[model samples]
Target: MTKAITLRADHGSDDLRRLARASRDAAQTRRLLALAAIYDGASRTEAARIGGVGLQIVRDWVARFNAEGPAGLVDRKAPGKSPRLGPEQRVALVQAVEAGPKPESHGVVRWRLVDLVRWMQDRFGVSVSRQTLGRELRRMGLRKLSARPQDQAQDPEPLEAFKKTFPPSWRRSASSCPRKPLELWWQDEARVGQKNGITRRWARRGTRPRAPHDQRTTWAYIFGAICPAKGKAAGLVMPYANTEAMQAHLTEISAAVEPGAHAVLILDQAGWHMSTHLAVPENITFLPLPPRSPELNPVENIWQYMRENWLSNRVFENYDDIVAHCCDAWNKLLAEPTRITSIGFRTWAHGS
Candidate 1:
């Protein structure tokens, strides 16, 4: 009769239990528990059940643990197939995404999925599906996003100047750790209505489920700001996002902050935001973002998050319904302050 495998005494002692308790990796913990069980005279089948893996996997893990110590339980790189694109081809692709297609040379105004696919085929002899290409682009931290309006003739000197004076400046360290608390509140305006956008959700296989969108083509703008240190959010809902509404929002934000503490608002240079008629509060300052750069403002992240989590896939009867739904979302999001802090905190301006 064939016999079952058992782990070594040294590897599966109380030390193994200590390692398991201290392990952050779930896979490693399971492996340690399985080994400890086996060392305690449990059958291979029993150990496999405890580890939530097949018996063969438990044996493989035991062998690896014997060969190297707790480190052996860490996930090893899969010896999979080599990459489709060569080194030079990947560099070319990255450069193309950064610089965009050359208008004069490529005779293309902007790059579409089909355009990128064609370019890759012609330039690197590679064929990639749209979905696969999207995955690769995401892996490279690139997204195919629709850009906001940018004035072509706008000078970038003022935007750079505003950055130098970022107050409560807390710079992140080389290890991506945040420094001192920054009093900067990220600010942005978003319009939500029956026309709110949609995101992917689970639906019956081979069937599509879609909510009413842009039905009334109406919207209510919400001006929101977040202080990461406090994890507190303040918002003003208004009929419009023009100069008057912006001033009102600023007034509300100024009131929300502590007395005599200067608050810096990092915002894009919208006409209403930078308009001469807009009143600048004494206790507040504006840090204008660079032209054509919407990604610089952390508040942009809140808009997408709100849509996805609380506001998407809804049907509103009237404009009042739209306002109610939108405000409810904002209130719910703000109720959990940690979510706000995690999404909108970026401290890179104050550095030596």
Candidate 2:
């Protein structure tokens, strides 16, 4: 014999009705409707039909509601379904990923999701989904990145020694002139052409924007220098990136500064930059970066910014158009000294 189920003393027909209306959870709404129907004197069979569940399920739900109220009727994770990795296990997993897998032992070049899944099970008797492993990796500051390999034989001591002594060494004679603050300019050269290179862009989902590859072959080398200390920039476009062009760029940079004011120029040890006929101006001093260390150059980032923004995915009709577009981009960049300062300033640079 099934006893009649009634609403609790604190709750009325209005309360049950409100619960059914307010609940966003469809499963919770169904349970509430069933309870409401029973309170309205409906039979058990009728309540089951209204709740869209079998009579036995409805009975089970009624028992839960009676034991724990509305909260009891809400869905819950199944028992023993919690994550396999505990806090300590998670920390261990992070450490293992950071160390990276040994190719000799792991028999793999890199850690893929499946590879990690197997590794976890082997190391800790834990089973984690690929998605779960990825989330854990991200939490521990791991990310997918393009790696540029450096030679193991190359020594980094020289680069370290150069950065250590550069700043205070320059400041010794940098502020001698009153007209200009110490203008520390980092210089780099880039080639802009008709085929500017492909980059990502927003488009309709499941569709790709195809660009015509019939771009002109002609290109021009652009030499640019950004002075963080003075919030200034100087650039020149030439047909070649040789000693003569570099000398011209250096002259242009030297001329842009206040008269009688000397400037410090940080540059990479490229052949053209070190050429005998480079003709470095008397007011400009060149500080060559360590070998194979373009990352230490702030001007390198400017090339990336230009390629990613104005030059990418653009097909110029002629060499003249490329020059015009590049000139416009540099003009826009030059007008925004704050942008230049923000992007160009490095901790090793004067005002960083």
Candidate 3:
């Protein structure tokens, strides 16, 4: 073999000296230590020992340094495989998603992962696994979200405008007199059990058992209110949700408040609440919630509590049964007005 190449001392080279001193990296320090050992007349074995590497590794580093210098010791850029989809293919995929799901794929109505993967193979002639497709979709900032069908007419602007005006309307005295305490009330109709369902099963001394049948029932609305201070709540069940129904609920609520107190009825800007036909007593003013912000209404909490505590898993045989159960739950809410008020006041109290 030819004579083995070795790093001779460049004692006068300021660049090498600066690189040795200024470098703070562990790998660079190790390499410099090995070089220093070699310059000090140590054997390759001793240099490898000082460098905490095998002699072969030390020799490799020495060879790299001789060929490409210190810069060569840094990591090289890793070359990765190209993506399965080209620019045109990715654009096509986005267009298909925007166009919505297609039928004849099956009885399936929605674009599920497996369906999309199959579609990609059929439409683009590009076969990709579900996991890979999911990753690609996410990389393109796509996410699955649910929305109400387009036919549902959701008018939120008036409700929003009312919410903004409500607090100020309540804060200002209905009468110019400053002595009257600020009395606020919320009125709304809550559906009791429109989506209630039940499964009924009967088993005898058993041959093959028959399948259980499901039962469903609908109930009317509960129009109600809560005073923020006393945790006082009162409401009534009505056959229909209309201005007449709302007027009756308001009349009951107005009767309950202390005499001479100005009351503001906080409610959503529903057609009935804003109807010209429905008359309000001079002491009772209406304040509507901001558009699309149902969470801002404290009375909603009472309805939620009722649903969770008494209504969710229970089955009512008829509308009358549901009405009775709702009345009982309403009474329980009335008994704890402080709780109702605490919940109602949360929106304003939290600066929300």
Task: Give the per-residue lDDT of model 3 (tens digit) for 15-100.
Answer: 55467677877687668767666766778888889889887888887787777776655556688877888888788878777677
Candidate 2, residue 23: lDDT = 84
Off by over 4 Å in 3: 1-36, 43-56, 59-111, 114-186, 194-214, 225-248, 255-261, 266-282, 287-310, 317-352
Tens digits of per-residue lDDT, candidate 1, 1-352, equal: 5455545556545788899999999989888888888778888899889999897888788888878878999997898977667778778888998888888878798887788888999997898887777777787788877655545775667546645654333222111223323356778899887766788878899999876666677778989888876788789888898999999988988898777466667777889999999888866667667776666676788888898888887877877887888789889988889998788776555332
What are the models' TM-scores? Answer: 0.58, 0.67, 0.51
Model 3 residue 123 lDDT score: 78
Per-residue error (Å), model 2, residue 83: 3.1
Candidate 2 global CA lDDT score: 0.80
For residues 51-112, write the lDDT of model 2, one tens digit per residue: 98888888888888878888887899878767667899888877777787899999988789
Best by TM-score: 2
Q: Which scores better on lDDT, 1 or 3?
A: 1
What C-alpha lDDT do the candidate models reach, one value each?
0.77, 0.80, 0.72
Q: Which candidate wins on lDDT?
A: 2
Clashing residue pairs in all predictions, respectively, total 1, 0, 8
